[model samples]
Target: MAQDAKTLDLIAIGRSSVDLYGQQVGGRLEDMSSFAKYLGGSPTNTAAGGARLGLKTGLLTRVGADHMGRFIREQLEREGVNVAGVLSDPDRLTALVILGIRDRVNFPLIFYRENCADMALQPSDVDETWFAQAGAVLINGTHLSQPNVYETSLKAARAVKAAGGRVAFDIDYRPVLWGLTGKDAGENRFVENQDVTAKLQEVVALCDLIVGTEEEIHILGGTTDTIAALRAIRKGAPDALLVCKRGPDGCVAFPDAIPDTLDEGVSARGFKVEVFNVLGAGDAFMAGFLRGWLRNETVETCCEWGNACGAIVVSRHGCTPAMPTWVELEAFLSERERPFRLREDVELEHIHWASTRDRVYDELTVLAVDHRSQFLDLIAETGGDPERIPHFKTLALRAVRQVAGRDEARFGMLLDGRFGLDALAQAADHDYWIARPIELPKSRPLEFESSADVATELTEWPAGQVVKCLCFYHPDDEIALRERQERQLLRLFDACRKTRHELLLELILPAGMDSDSRTVARAIRRLYSLGIRPDWWKLEPLQDAVAWRETEMAINENDPLCRGVVLLGLSAPEAELLASFEVVAPFPIVKGFAVGRTIFYDVARDWLAGRIDDEAAVAALASKFKVLVDAWRRLRGAAEKAA
Candidate 1:
C-alpha cells in the first residue's frame, strides 16, 4: 500500500520492543516492585517525540508477533504513530529490555535481539515509498553494531536519502550490547564483543546527523572529557549536525556560521524541572532534537527544546511516557525566546556536475515548443554543431526556454494585478501550477483607467476558485496612492467572498524600491480589513534584497500580511539571513526562474505551444527545472537546529 498522506514527519527505523522499568524501593532489586511495562526502543521514542510535537510520525521497525509485539504497536498507535510499515514476525517474542535504576543511573538488561523481530528486519522490509513520505528518518547506531541489523539500517538510510528525505543516526552506544565492559579498553570491540568500533566508525560517516551522550562519545573517542569526545564525533560527521546531550549542564550548540551579524553561544538551562528518573533522559533529548530539527529551529534553540523535553521525560517514571506533546514544546519555547524559538525549513545539498559540452543543449531540446524547436534547430544550423557543435550562451537561451516548457505542468499563473482572485484555484484544485505577478509600473494593471469607482464593480464581482494569485503595484512610482490601494483592496475582499476556494497571493514589490513603510502599512490595513491573507509576498528578488536588509525589516514591520512572505528568486546572503530569521521567514521561494525576454512577445505567447518530440531531451529539461526549484527554495529565514 502507498504511504499515508498523514504520514509521519519523523520515521524511526529500528527495533520496537517492550521495556520493563523497576525502581529500588529502599535497596532490594525486585522485578515486581512498582514495575512499569511500556513500549520502548530508541526508534520508538524518536517517533513518539515527533508525534507529540504535532508532527505526523511513523515507525518502521521489527517486533515479535506475540503479546509484546502487539503491546508495542498499540503503544505507538496511541502516540499517533503510523504503523503501516511496522513489520511483525512470529519468530521471536518482541525484544524485551529490563532496567533497574540504581542511584539515578540506568543499568538496563536486554534479551538477545539476534534473530529477534527487530533484529530480523531485512532490506526487503522497507521501500522508498515509506521513506519518501517522511521528513526525517532516525536510525539506531547500536543496531548498526550487528551485521544483519547494521547492514539493514545502512540500506534503510540510503533508501531514505534516495526518497529525498533526511537521515539522523542515533549513536545509542550500548557497551553491554557489545560486551565491551570486561574486555581490556585496548581490545578490539569486534573481536572481544562480536561488535566492533571499526564498523561503527564507518557507519558514523554514513549518517547525516549524529546524537551521542558524553559517555558514548568517550567510548567512541577513548577520551575522558565530553568536549574532546564531541570534537571526535564532529570529525566523523563534520557535515552532519553533532548533538551531544550533557547530563546536568545545559546543552551546547553549533549552527553553521553565516559570516558576520550572527551571534552564536551555548544555551542556558531554560527550565528547572523536577527530575523523576534518568533512564529515558537521553532518549527524550533525542526526541526533542528530532522535533526541533524537523521544525528548522536554530542550533541553540534545537538544543533548548532538547533540554526541555529531556527534563520532562526524566521527571516521569516510564520510558516514552514522559514525552511532552507538540503543544507542550511550543509553549515551552514560547516562554524562553532566547534560544528556544521554534522554527523549521527543508534542507538539500548542492553538487556541481561535469558533463558533455553540449549537455545544456541536449537537455533543453526536450522542452522545445514548435517555435523554440524551429528556432533551436536554426541556431543549431547557424552555431550549434550540425553534428557536434558546442553552443554556449545563445544555446543557453534556448535551453532556458526549454527548461520553462518542461515545467509547464507545474507552471503557475502570475498576474500583475493587485489581487490574485483567479490564480489560487488553479494551483490547488487544478494543476499544481504557480501564478506570480510582476510589479506593474502603475498602481494596478495598465488596463485600469484610474483608481476610481472600480471598487463597486469589484465588490460585486464573482470570486475565483484559483489556488494562486498575483498582485502588482509600482513601489518606485509610488502611484496607487494609499487611499487608492485601500479601495483596490476592498475589491479583492469582495472577490474573495465570492469563492470558497483557498488561494495564495503573490504580491510583487517594485524592483527599484524594495520597501516602502507607508506603502506596506496601507496594504496591510486594506488586507486586514478584507480579512484576506497573503501567503507569500515577493519583495524585491533575493539578489536585489540582500543589500537591503534594512528595507526588508522595515517593510515586514509595516506589512502584517507579509507574515507568510516568501522572497522569490533570491540570490543574496542577506536574503538567506532574512529567511532564517526567528520571526520572519521567506518560505518556498521561487527559483530557477524561467522568463522570456521582453523582445519575445510575438513568439513567447507560443512558448507552451509544442510537444517536444525527444523523450530524453524532455526528461532532461524536467530534471533541470526541478534542480533549479530546489536551489531557489533554499533562500529562507533563520532556523533552529541542534548542535
Candidate 2:
C-alpha cells in the first residue's frame, strides 16, 4: 500500500482490557467499597487518546465474546476509533485489571490475564491489508513478552513497515506480565531479565520511533543506567527517535545520538499539576506524542504535546477518559501559566466535559412521556387502574420505536423512572438519547423526586442518561422564592457535574409572569449569573424570531458549548405547536422539540377509557408525532435554504 492509500493515522496492536479502578482514593484495594470501570491497556489507551486528539486511529486486538468485550468495542467506537480490527475470541474471556489509587506514587493493581483474549491473539490475526492502511503502527513491550503475542505484534509491525508505514514502540515494561515478578505485583514497573532485553532489542531494531520511561529504558538496554540503556538501543537503531518520559520533569527526545546528560537532548518541560493517580500517564504521553509525530512535527513539539498530556492525566483519574480532546489540549497549551491544581480549573474541566461527550445532536426530536402527575390524573379521570401506567409508558416507547425504527438518529425520549422504568431500560438498551426526570413533578422550589441526595441517586442511573430537571422558575419572583429555587438548581448542577451526567434544565415561567419575548431569556441569564451552566436547556417556544435570538444569545454568551435548546409543548394543540415551531425554526440554537401531551394525551386517554385498543393508541400517537417531526424538519429545511 502506498502512503497516500493509508486511511488510518495509527494502528495500535497490543493489550486491551477493562480496568476497574477503586473509586475511593488513598484506600487499599482490599478495603475499597466500589470500583469504577474504564477502558485499560497501554496501547488501547494510546489508541483512544489519539482518537480523542483528532487522530483517525484503529485498535488491532481481540476481545472475548462477552459483555465486557462488547463494552471495549463499544467504548472504542464511541471514541471514534475504528473497531473493524477488534476481533472477538470465543474461547477466552477478555482481560481485566483491578487497580486502586493508594496515593500519588502508590497504585496497587492485579491483572487477571490467565489466558486472556488479547493474549490469545495469533499471528494470522494480523491483517496485512488492514495494517497497511495505517500510516503508523504502535506495539507495546508487554505484547513482546510472550512468544505467541510477540510474533503476532512483530507480524503487524512488519506489515506496516513493508507498506511504507512507520512503526513506533512503547517500552511498556511490566514484569508481572513477563513472568519476572509475582502475579499479584502488577504495579511493579521493572524487573530485569536478559530474555526480555533481547526481545525488546529485536523490536527496537524494527521501529522508527521509541518511547519509554527511564526504568523502561534501563530494562530495554540490559543495564540500570539510563544513558547506557539509550546507547545500547541507539547502537542497534541509531536512526530511531528515542523519547524518555521523565514524569513531572517532562520529557526529553533524542533524534540522533544519546547525550551525556538527559537535559542535553531536545526536552519539553511538563506542567506543574497535582497528581491524582499516575498509573496511565505514560500511555497518555505516547498518545500525545503520536498526535504530533504522525503529523511529521518537530521532536520538540512532540515532546511538548506528550508532556502536557501526561501532566493532565496525572492530575485526574483513569487513563482513556483523562485523555484531553484537541480543544482541551489547545486550551491548556495556550495558557501562559498553567494551573498547578488542574482539577480546580473550572473552565478546563467544563471544556473537557463538553468536548468529550459522545453524542452530538444536530437536531433532537424527543417524545416526552415523563409525566407522573399527569398520567395519574388521566388514570383517575378514566376510572382506570394506575398500576397500568408502567405498561402504558412501555407501549408509548413502542410507539416511539415504530416511528424511529433504528436508522433515525434524531429521535429521543424523556422518561421517568416512576412510570417509565421498563421503557427507560428498553430505550437505554437500544442506546437512544434518553433524558430521565430528577425533580419532583410540579415542585415549586425544585425538590428531588425520591432522594434528597440527588448526586447519590444519580449513581444508580446509567452514565448516558441525561438528568432532566423541570424548574418552574421566574426571575421576577419574590426574593425568598427565587433564592430557594436558585439554591436547589445550584445543588442539582453540582450533582450533575459530579456524576458526569448531562443536565437538561427545563425552565418555565410560573403560571403567569408578565409574558414577553425576554422572560425565559432573562431567566436563563439569571441562572448563568448563578454559575449554573447546563449542557442543555428545554424551554417553551417564544412568540417571534427576536425572542428566539435573545434566548440563543443568552445561551451563547453563557456557554458556547451548550448542547442547544429544545422546545417544550406545554400541552398546546398540534396546530398551535406547529406554528410555534415555524417561528423558532429559523434560529440556529433551536434543536427540534420535546412535546408529550400534544402527541400522546388524546391517544393515551382514549386507550385508558377503552375507546381505543393498544394498536389504535400506538398508531394515533405515531401519527401525531410524525406530523410534528415533519413540520420541524420542513421549517428547518426552509431556514437552511434561506441561510
Candidate 3:
C-alpha cells in the first residue's frame, strides 16, 4: 500500500457551493424572515473547520466562475484550504442552496443548482496523482451520485487506497441535488429513481473512514442493529474506520476492525453543551477528527477532540461565529477544572430601587422576595420566562447554557468588590459580570476638566475592554423652566469625553422633566450641532398625564438625532409609556432606575468623604444601590492615584 509519491494528511473531493441561510419566524417554516448569506457547503465547511484547527486541508470541486463561486473560493481561501485542484467552469453558474433553520433538529435546504459545475467534475480533472498523495481522502457522496464525477470519485478513491492513502467519505446525502437526471425526458430523477442510500453503503465498505450523522446512519442502516451495520460494512470493506456524529453527545468511532459483537467495538460518549443554530456542527467535528488523525493521535483521542470541537461549535448561533480559536481550544483542553466563561461579563444587582420589593424583602430573602405578578406579566407580555431570578449572573447563566441549569459546565459571575490590574487579569478568566457600583468623589462630583485625566488613567487598564459610565441630569437645574443649561451641558460633555475612557455613562434624568421640554429639545439639537457623540443619551420626555398617546407624542417629537436616544427614562405612571413606543427604540427603557446623589447623596457622600467604613458600605449595599454624590474612599483612593 506504500505507493504514493508523498504523504499528506487529508484530501477532500466534493461539490462546493454557497448556502444562503435564512431564519424561520414564529413556527412557520415556509414563511421565512430576512435571509443572511455565508460561504457554506458540506465539504467546504468540513475543510474550513480542518484548516481552522491548523490542519493542512484541500478541496477538489468544479465551480462556475460566478459571484457565488468566487465567494466560496474566497471563503475557503480565508480558511487556508489549498485550492490547487478546485477548477472553474466558465459556462455554468456556481451552485447555491437556500437553507432554512427551522429548529435545532430540522434544516430544510432548497438547492437552486441545475447542472451546476461542481457536479460536472470528470475523471480527467486530475490524474490519480492527487489522490495518491494524501494520507486520507474525503469524498462527498453528492458528486458520486452523478455519473461522470461519481465514477471518477470511485476510481480515484481506489487509486488512493492502493497508494496507501486512506479514503474518508462523507455521505453528504442531498435529495434535490441527486434525483434529477436530465432535461429532455431522460432516465433522470436524482433522488427518486436511485437507491443512493444503499450505493453509499457500498462506498462505505471501501472508505478508510466513513463519517455521517445519525440520520444518515438511519437512512443506510437497512434495519440492521449497530452490530449488523458493522457486519454489512465489513462485508464490503472489512478494514476501515466507521464514525457517526451525534451532535452534543459527540460522536462514535469504530476503526477498521469490527468485532463479532457491538459491545466489543470502540464506544465513547461526547462532550455536553446547549446548542443554537447547529447546522455545521457535524462538519466542524469531522475537521476535528481529521486534525487529530493527522497528528497521529490515538483513535480514542481523535474522537475525544472531535467531541470537544463539536461541543463548542454547536453552543453558539452560527457555524463560524463561535468557532474556538486555536489558543482558546488549547486552553479549554488544558484548563480542566475551570468552567467555560463567555468572552465578556455583564453586571446586574439586587438593587434597592423597588419600594414594594423592599416590603417583600422584610419578610423574605432577596431571592425569595419575588414579584409574583410582575413575573407573570413579564412572561405574558413578552414571552420571557418567570421562574428565574432577575440578576445579571442568573440571566447570563441561562443564556449561555441555553436552558435553566444546575450544571457546572456553564458559569455566571457577580462582582466581589475588586479592581485594577490583578482583578482585571483574574477577570479575564470570568465569564459573567456583577453590577459593581463605582462611586464619584464625595468632596466633588466628577467635572469635565478632570474627565480626560481619568481617561488617561484608564488607558493603562486594558485594551478593547468595556467600562460602564454613570451620570445624571439635574431636575432642579434652570434648563427645565427657563432655557438650556449651557454651562451644565458643557460640563457634561467634558465629563463624557473623560469618562469615555474608563467609565461607562449611565445618564440619569429626572422622572418629571422627561418630556419634550423645549429646553431639553434645544439641548439635544445643540449636542447634535456640536458633533458631541455620547455613548448613550437617555430620553426621558414624560408628560404629567399617564396616557400612551402622551408618551407616544413625547417620544415621537422629532429630535435632531433620533438614534442617539439610548435609554427611555421613565418612572411608575410613565411605565405604560413603554407600550406607547410604536417601535421600541433600539434600546430598552427599564424601571427602578436609582441614582447616588439623587437618592443617598447624604450618607454615601459622607461615606466617600471617609465618614464610613467598609462595613458601613456593605451595610449600604444591603439597604440600597444609590447614586451618592461620590463613591466611597475605596474608589477615591484609586482616583487620587490616577490624578
Error of 2 at 7 (Å): 0.3
- Candidate 2 lDDT by residue in tens digits, 297-358: 88889999999999999999898889999999999998566678889888888899999998
**TM-score for predicted model 3 compared with the true structure:** 0.51
Question: Could you tell me every candidate's TM-score relative to the true structure?
Answer: 0.48, 0.99, 0.51
Error of 3 at 118 (Å): 1.2
Candidate 1 deviant stretches above 4 angstroms: 1-7, 106-114, 182-195, 256-265, 268-270, 331-643
Report the Cα lDDT for residue 361, model 3.
9
In candidate 2, what residue range of length 10 has the lowest lDDT sum?
335-344
Per-residue lDDT over 50-79 for candidate 3, one digit per residue giving the tens place of the 0 to 100 score: 776776778788788987787678667766
Top candidate (TM-score)? 2
| Span of 10 residues, lowest total lDDT, candidate 1 | 345-354
Q: Rank the candidates by lDDT, best first.
A: 2, 1, 3
Residue-level error in angstroms, candidate 1, position 185: 16
User: For model 1, how does the per-residue alpha-carbon lDDT over 1-643 read when each residue is reduced to its tens digit?
Assistant: 1234425577788867787767443243444465557778777877876676677788888878788888788677767789887888977778877665544443444445546788777778877676777767888866875777777787877776776677887777766556555422211222223235456667666667777765565665446555665566667767777665666665655443212211233464645554446766777788887777877777777888788777666655666765766655555556443222121100000000001000111011111111223334544444533221111212323333454554434343333223222223223343223332222233354223323444333333223222333456544445455446545454553443322222345455545655544454454444554445443343433333342344444445443223233433322343343343322223222222322221222232232232232343334444554454444333221221211
Off by over 4 Å in 3: 1-8, 23-29, 180-194, 256-264, 320-325, 335-643
Clashes of each: 48, 0, 28
Model 1: what TM-score? 0.48
Q: State the lDDT at 311 in candidate 3.
A: 70
